[model samples]
Target: MTRLWNDPQEFVDEMVEGFVLANQGYVRRVRGGVTRSTASPEPEVSLVIGGGSGHYPAFAGLVGPGLAHGAAMGNLFASPSSTQVESVVRASDRGRGVLLSYGNYAGDVLNFTAAQDAVRADGIDCRTVLVTDDIFSAAPDSRATRRGIAGDLTVFKTAGAAAAAAYDLDDVERVAILTNDRTRSMGVAFTGCTLPGADEPLFSVPEGRMAIGLGIHGEPGIDETDIPSADGLAELFVEHLLADAEIPEGVDPATARVVPILNGLGSVKTEELFVVFRSLVKRLGERGVTLVDPQVGEFCTSFDMAGASLTLLWLDDELERLWTAPADTPAFRRGVVPTGAGVSASDAPSAAAAAAITDLDAEGQRDDAGADVPDSSAESRQTATRIAGLLRLVSDTVSENAAEWGRLDSVAGDGDHGIGMQRGATAALEAAESAERAGAGARTLLTRAAAAWADRAGGTSGALWGVILRSLASELSDETVPSAGDIVVGAVRGRDSVMSVGGAAVGDKTMIDALVPFTEALDAAVSGGASLADAWQDAADAAERGAESTTGLVARLGRAKTHGDRAAGSPDPGAVSFAALARAVANTLKNDTEEES
Candidate 1:
């Protein structure tokens, strides 16, 4: 359904470039995403908000005075890598502390938390407030587990307003948490969204039917029913929202003041939203509820999804004030911006921020490029060349099997695993090739590949793969060729690193299922005096079995977990990809052994 694109792989980057070009007064391009182009005279707490790139106004469009200072844009429906998040944080930081906010997806949590820690280590005070407001994702008692939907606006707006008012880091975080606690949202879709270069939508409802409680990432809904009229849909929304269980604690629906946000997901027009809002307002008024600052339009979206979500933020005195505060972002504007809130375009300082960011990024790249290469033995240099070829094999295998991986992921997840793996592997291959041509040895080449995979791919798989390769690289030597024993130790380290970093166990229905078995089998074979190639074959077979076992298991972690048993009959795409990669490497090793014989 995404028709206009020069190259599917470059879609996000191109989209960001165009957004910056169009909104020069509001935002400027940074390494990761965009930051405010205009600087305030005094330092204030920076609110850095972001997630995947498809949710237009939810992120970059909200960067300006009285809103987010910057946004860390990720791939379509994927979380940004930690490197990307950190880059955005540094670019946005003033003397004041920083607050990071985003939807509470697993990948976002992992990446943002890592960035927070990284900045804190550099003496920058940083905090995180996750938006968990989609009522259908979790029960009232388990609200903290819910994923954020359109309610992201309520949290980000309140936090950004508090920061603009010169509130300290602690208060900004507090208000953000308070806003998230009061907000509740639900979404429905008449159809599904299709990713670029994909042949079909991620999931589809039957004709004349609608999917209820679907995620913004094109994930299938929890239930399907016949389409309802505008009034009926409004009633459905009001009934579910005003339910005693769904209402915020200590709030009386009959006497509450709420900010109602009627958000179009993507393809739905403003006219249709107004039609629904008309009935919705009447229903709320009849129940004695007072609505203030009702917003109706596209605030968050899934690319071309014919759906919408309703979000309600129960407002107290403080929250009401913050909610209605002035914000002059590209998409969201409220009241009149205070004078001196931002610098004028011709003020020289406006260009300084962009120039400073570009210089810092260039400096980092130069440091990496000019880092001294460690001396290597002749055997280790030859092994590095072979490793580069093996990386190319991985890239080819993942690219060839990407479609099947995407299909498997669509059963419950956002369906980007295949594309992510392909991007990471290709980037890793390119980095390895460049490092090899630079006369780098085994450890240095792998380190470069690891960083490239994480930086280019930007997701959960990308982060974990970077960890795996980095751990393996640590075990390799520039001075001598690595022995089978060293490889086994490295495999064990990679497994441990993945578990520690991803926080997934073997039965959690993640890539760990296959990775654990592969590492264990390789360790056993090597310990029993097997050759590296033969041991790798045994490990690959074990990984295949582990991946197959996931077909009967329910996901207990990550995005798929929200769908409960919907993923039970299909192998996790992550586990399947791990098995495939292991097998591909094994095949390459077998060929190498045959040629040597």
Candidate 2:
């Protein structure tokens, strides 16, 4: 369990701050995460790697000379935002290209791909190498679907070393790909991990049982069995990796030179790993495999998960050379490299990059946001005020039901949905209210709210809500108050935007389930000549029905997708929150319209 924190939402930020403060000799704080204290002197390839927090030495600890140039740290167990990645990239970019590497999680893929495109558009070359070494996540033929686990270390290390050795961007990328290909890991857990401020674990293993092939993000494993002895566990890991045929086709299993990583996920102390590693080495030697510099310690970890993983990196000549290269960071280190030999901090960021990093949240939220509000008619001002009221109601409703939402989400997902929604709604309310006080028009108010929601929430829900609000804002013109028809169009647009951005269909057991029905009902009612408030009420009711119907759904998307059966009979937290927000908006509309009348 997490022992200390101010706000759970701020945990990642505070963690990053403290990490930089402690490792000032190795890393410096950037907007996103951290960059090497001593930058590359020449425009050589830069290695940028990251994922969620909790995983210590695997990421930020690997940033330094002859290792990653920077890391983009996201919230705990969440992927960093594209903006965050771009900020880190720009902060660390030299004239040479950048190599982006991370565990192959869905959110990480989406955000990192977007960031890659953004940087390439800016004429800064960017390439990505996704680590997919967890063999049990998918069949051997479909290795692309496998999630990276402790194997993340090998790929990142190889790529960073290649970049440090002054390999071109293409070579750095190639090494990263090769490392991922040659690496495979399998993890087992005796218990599940708890997140900050959460009362329970993300998952649990029955007493005396063990979960096998678990993820580093506290995701439950795919297989289970009775707990095994240290020797038995080592044998289990070796058999799994060997049977998967992950070693290069030409490499013989009997004599392949490999770097074995015996990694403690978390709460599996160093002593336990050493005990396991002893058996692991003996088993490998008996199999006629030669081990080189086998690593034994925490690499990538889940927060306090009582588990460990074994990774085998079958090395080629180049890989073996890079694997042992001298490196230094707060956590990971090897042979020492010359100081002041790489890009220096004096290079810093371009003015544009600096601005993007500094104003990441604030710059995205504005419409005509400056204190200068164009003169608007009383009706427009009233509409803006109503938008503020809607967010206030949403904030209150979400705050009141936050715990229930968390409970429902905990049944299937990471259990942060409720608190995430509350944070976003509250932030949106404050931002919208401020916009209204600034005498902004309807569109400006909603746009401000949308940005604030996304900026504060910091998860899938946050990004989706931002898209929904932005879509709705697009419907309301700055000049006129929104009519029932306009509202209906906005709802439709919001629904479509959610689907487009979220990649979740109505039946995927996400917010889309409720959002689609709500929009349809709103459209139908408005077309039937219903008043705005009445139509909104109808939409809200439809949303509730849709949310309730989700109890029968098996999630096909997001975190719950892996535990579909376990999630049956529970409504998606996102869907339920959407329904609640719809009702709150409807209530606000009714009250405001009645007062005006």
> Each model's TM-score?
0.96, 0.93
TM-score of 1: 0.96
Highest-TM-score candidate: 1
CA shift of 422, model 1, Å: 1.4
lDDT of 2 at 164: 80
What residue runs in model 1 are displaced by over 4 Å at the alpha carbon?
339-372
When summed lDDT is taken over every stretch of 10 residues in candidate 1, the lowest stretch is 359-368
Clashing pairs in 1: none
lDDT of 1 by residue, 1-597 (tens): 889888777889899999999998888787878888887656789999998888888799999888899999988898888878887888788768899999999889988888889778867899999999998898899999999999999999999999989999999999999999999999999989988999988888899999999999988999888999999889989988888898888888889999999999999999999999999999999998999999999999999899989999999999999999999999999887654534544332234445644543532241346545678877888989989998999999999999899889888999888888887888788888877877889988888888878876778888899889999999998878999999999889999988998899989999999999999999999999999999999999999999999999999999999885999999999999999999999999999899999
